[model samples]
Target: MNSEPANRRIVRAPRGTTLTARSWQTEAPLRMLMNNLDPEVAERPEDLVVYGGRGRAARNWEAFDRIVATLTDMSDAETLLVQSGKPVGVLATHPDAPRVLIANSNLVGKWATQEVFDALERQGLMMFGQMTAGSWTYIGSQGIIGGTFETFVEAGRQHYGGDLSGRWLLTGGLGGMGGAQPLAGVMAGCSVLAVEMRPAAIARRIESGYLDREAADLDEALRLIDEAKASGTAISVGLLGNAAEVYEEILARGDLPDLVTDQTAAHDPLQGYVPAGWTIDEWESRRERDPAGVIAAAKVSMARQVRAMLAFKARGVPVFDYGNNIRQMARDAGVEEAFDFPGFIAAYVRPQFCRGRTQFRWIALSGEAEDIRVSSEALKGVVSDPTFTRWIEMASERIRFQGLPSRSYWMGLADRVAAGLALNRMVAEGVVSAPIVVTRDHISSGSVASPNRESEGMLDGSDPVADWPMLNAMSACSSGATWVSLHHGGGTGIGFSQHAGFACVADGSDAAAAKIARVLGNDSSVAVFRHADAGYPEAVETARAEGLRRPYAEALRG
Candidate 1:
C-alpha cells in the first residue's frame, strides 16, 4: 500500500544543533523531514499533505515513525533508501555517500496519467513529491516568496520600464507555493488580486501575513485593487472563488489588469484544481468515486480558463503561464491557441537559468532565528551580489520563520560554493550557532525536464529530454551531497516532468567543507552545462567565464 493518511498527528522538528542522530548529515534530514510536516510549514499536515496537490512528506504515520527510528539509529557509514515517501532500506555505504537517497512518484511513461496514478495511490503504491514536498526541502511560503517577488519585479522591468507602481496583477491559487504571490506582488510594487477556490486557504494566507485582506466578493476585491492602483500603492486582496469563474467575470467586466498569471494546481486536475462551478465537497466526492469524470470536467474548466487568458492576451495585456501545465491541459481539451502566451521561465526567469542562478536556500539546524540572521550576513560577505545583499536584508527583516529559520536567494555556482564554505566555517568557528543544510527547489535550470516550465522553448528544442535530472542526482551523490532525490511529475503533472533535489550539510568539519564545495560547484556546473548545450549564448558565456572546459560551447552557440 502507498500510505495511511488517516493516521494524523501533530509533528514538530527539533530546534537545536544537538545531534538527534549519529551526525549532522542524518540529523539535518530528520529535522527537515519533520519540518515538512510541521503545522506551520505544511498545507495539510494532518493528511500528510505538504503542498502542491497532495504532495506528501511520508507514506503514512507508520512510515514516518520507522523513518525517524532508522535515522536515529543509523550509522554514519550507511545510507537509507526511500521509495516515494516510504522508507525501504538501509544499505552499507561509505561515510561520504549520501545519508539518504529518494525516488518519488515515478512511473512508466505510458502509465503516467491521472487515472493510472490515482489507481496506484488508491492501492498504496505511490506518493506525489511536487518539487520540494517529498524531498524534505520545503521551507514554507518563505521558500518561494523571494523568487516570486523577484519574478514580479523582473516582469515589471521587462514590460513597464522597471516600475510596477499603479499596476495590478491578477492570479489564482493561495496554497503553499502560490500563497507567496500576494506578498510578493505587494513587495514588487504592484497591487495583487489573488483568487483562491478554498475558503480556508484564503484565511490561512491572511493569518500567516502573506495576504493583506480578503474580499467578501468580486466587487470588493476589485474596489480594493482599484484604490491601490489609483494611489500607486502596493496592496494585496484575496478573493474567495474559483479562479476560472472569477477570471471570466473579470473579462466580462472588462477590468484589464496590467499583468496576469496563475498558480492553481492545474497540473493535477483531479486533486489540485476544482472544476469552475463545483463546490469543494462535490469535487472531492467525484474525485474519489469517478476520477475519469472529474478529469474530463476539470480539463473543460481549464480550457475555459485558458480561453479567458487568451482573451486578455489578445487585448494587449501581458499574460503568461505560471508553469502549472494548464496550457497543455487546455490544448488537450481542444483549445488550439493554448500556447499563444509564454510560460514564466521563458518570459522572465530563463536568463537567470542561463547563468546557473537558482533559488538556493539554507536552513539552520539549530532552528534559531539568530543563526539564520548571522548566516544571512555571512552570505552577503561571501556573494557580494547586489541582488543577494538586498534580498538577504529584506528577508532578514521581513520574512517570518515558518517551520525552521532559513533564508533563500538567487545565486550562481561560484557564489553558492563560497557561501557553502563560509557557512561551514561559521559552524566550525561558532560564529553562528550550528550547522546549516543547503538545498534548492527542484524546478532548477539543469535538474528539471518539463516542456511547459523549466525546459520550455529551448534553443535546441530538447525540452522533453529527461536525462539531465538523472545526471544531476547522480552527480550530487558522487559529489557528496548529504541527501539526493529524483522525482517525477514535479511542477508539471504526471508524464509531464522529471527533476531532482539535493541537500548538503555543512557541519563545520573539514570533511563537510570539502563535500559542500564539490557538491555546490559540480551541481551548478552541470546546470549551466545543460543550458549551454541548449544553445543559449548566455549560458555558453557563463560556462566559459566560470572556466569550465567545454570546447564545443562556442560552436554550439554559433
Candidate 2:
C-alpha cells in the first residue's frame, strides 16, 4: 500500500451531471477510473485492486493521479495513451479518434511470463489489469452475476433437467469475478459453497450482498450447505479456508457437489494464487522475498486443486474451469489430466458467443437507477429475444448497481445493435436521463485468442493466433468506439492470451447515433465472420439471415 496522502483511501467519483473534464468522452474515462476504485465497486481500493488477484486500476498511486490529471485537461480532440495502467502520452487527433487508448500487461512473446511481470511490477514498470479492471469498465460483481447465472441455468438445463433446486455448487475464490458466483448460484436456486482464503474477500462479498453468510470452518460450512440443501433454500456461504485443502477434503468425502468449479487467480501463480501452507500475510511477504519459490508452491497447490476437481468429475459430477486458466497452470505443474474438464465458455457459452454474444453491459452516465430504468424499458422495446428480455427483468429485480447504474446481459449481434440504437434514440429524445455507455468483455469475435478459455476448441484451431484481437481493436477504432483497448494476459495468464475492449457512448447527438450504429454493427459482424470462416453453421445462418456484408458471407452467398 502506498502510504502517500493522495493514495491511501477509497476514491469516489463526482456524480449527477457534473463534468470535471471538458467533455463526456474524457469525463467518461475519468469518472470510470474513479468509480472502479469506489469502495463499493473495488475489492481493495487502497491498493487500487479492482479484482482478480492483483488486477489493478492503475500501476500505482502516482500513475493513477497522473492518469486522472491527464484526463482532466485533455482536449476533446486529444487522445490519451495508457500503458499497463500508466498514462504515457497525449496525442492530437480527430473527433472520431478514441478518447483513450490502453494496453495493459502486454509483453513480448519471449518474455511474457509472470516472473518477468512480477519483476517489472516490483520495479514499478507494470501491473496486471485482469479483464475489465484495467479497461475502466468494471461495474462491480453485478457485471459478472448475470453471466454466471446464465451458466448455472445452462448447467441445470443440461444436467439437472432445467432445475437446480435443492442442489449445491462448489467453487473457489472470492475475487472480483468469482464473488458473483454465490449470488448467481442462489439466483439459479442452488446453494453455493464458495471457499475464499481472505477474510477481507469474504467480508467484501458479504457487504456487497452476494454472500449470505460465512462459515466458521469446513465442518460448519458443510453443515450450512447440507442445511440449505435440505430446506431447498437458495443461499451462498463463504468458507474461509485454502482452496487446495478444502478441495482435497471434499474429495475424501464420498458425496460430491452437484457442480464444481474454481476461480482462484491461478493464471498468475506468483502473485495471484496463494500457496496452501502459507498465511495470507506470509504469502504476500514471501512473494516479494522469493517469487520463484512462491510460483513453484502455488503451481503445486493448483495441481492439487485440479486433481480434486478431476475426482468430482470422475464421479459424474458437473465440473468446469471458470476461465481462470488454472488447468493450464496445473498442467505445467505435471498434472497430465488437468484439462479433463471443459472450460465454462467451451461447455456453456460458446454457441451463443458464436453469434457475437458474450458478456455485454451498458452504464447510465447520470448514475441514477431511473436512468437505467428508462434505458431498460427502451431496450426491452428494441430487443425481441425473449431470453434477453427475461434476463433484463431478472437482473433489474436482483442486481444492485455498485457504481454507475448499469445493466448487463448476453445478446447476439442483431439484438445488441438494436439495443444500442434504441438507447441512442432514447438519449436523443430525452427519454433517458443521460447518455449510455456500452461495454463488452474482451471475448468478442476477432477480439481474443486464448486457447484455454475464449477460443478453446475453436473449429479452425486458430485459438493461439494473436492477430484476431489486434484486428478487433482496429475495427472498433475505425467503427467509432469512444475508447479502445488491446490487452494481454486477461482471464488466462501471461503469454497465453491477447484480447481487446470496446466502449461507445451514446450522447444523443447525430455523431453519437452514427457511431453506435456503425460500431455495434461492425463489431458484431466481425465475430459472425470469424465464426463463419471457422465453419460454424449457426454463425453462417445468422450471417445469411442478417445479410451481413463480409468477405466470407459474400463468398458463400455467391
Q: lDDT for each of the candidates?
A: 0.89, 0.85
Give the clashing pairs for model 2: none
lDDT of 1 by residue, 1-558 (tens): 123345547888888767888878899999999999999999989888999989999887778889999999898899999998899999999999999999999998988886788779889989888889999999999988877887899999999999999999999999898899998898889999999989999999988888999999999999998888787698899998988889999999999999999999899888889998899999999987898889899999999999999999999999989889999999999999999999999999999898988878999888888898877887777895777887777666667889888888888888888988999999999988888999988878889999989899998999899999999999999999999999999888889999998999988999999999999888888889999888799998998899986767555657
User: What global local distance difference test value does model 2 have?
Assistant: 0.85
Q: Model 2: which ten-residue window has the lowest total lDDT?
A: 1-10
Runs of candidate 2 exceeding 4 Å displacement: 1-4, 556-558
- How does each model score on TM-score? 0.97, 0.96
RMSD of 2: 2.1
Relative to the unseen true structure, what is the C-alpha lDDT of residue 20 in candidate 2, on a scale of 0 to 100?
A: 83
Model 1: lowest-lDDT 10 consecutive positions:
1-10
How far off is residue 213 in model 2, in Å?
Answer: 1.6
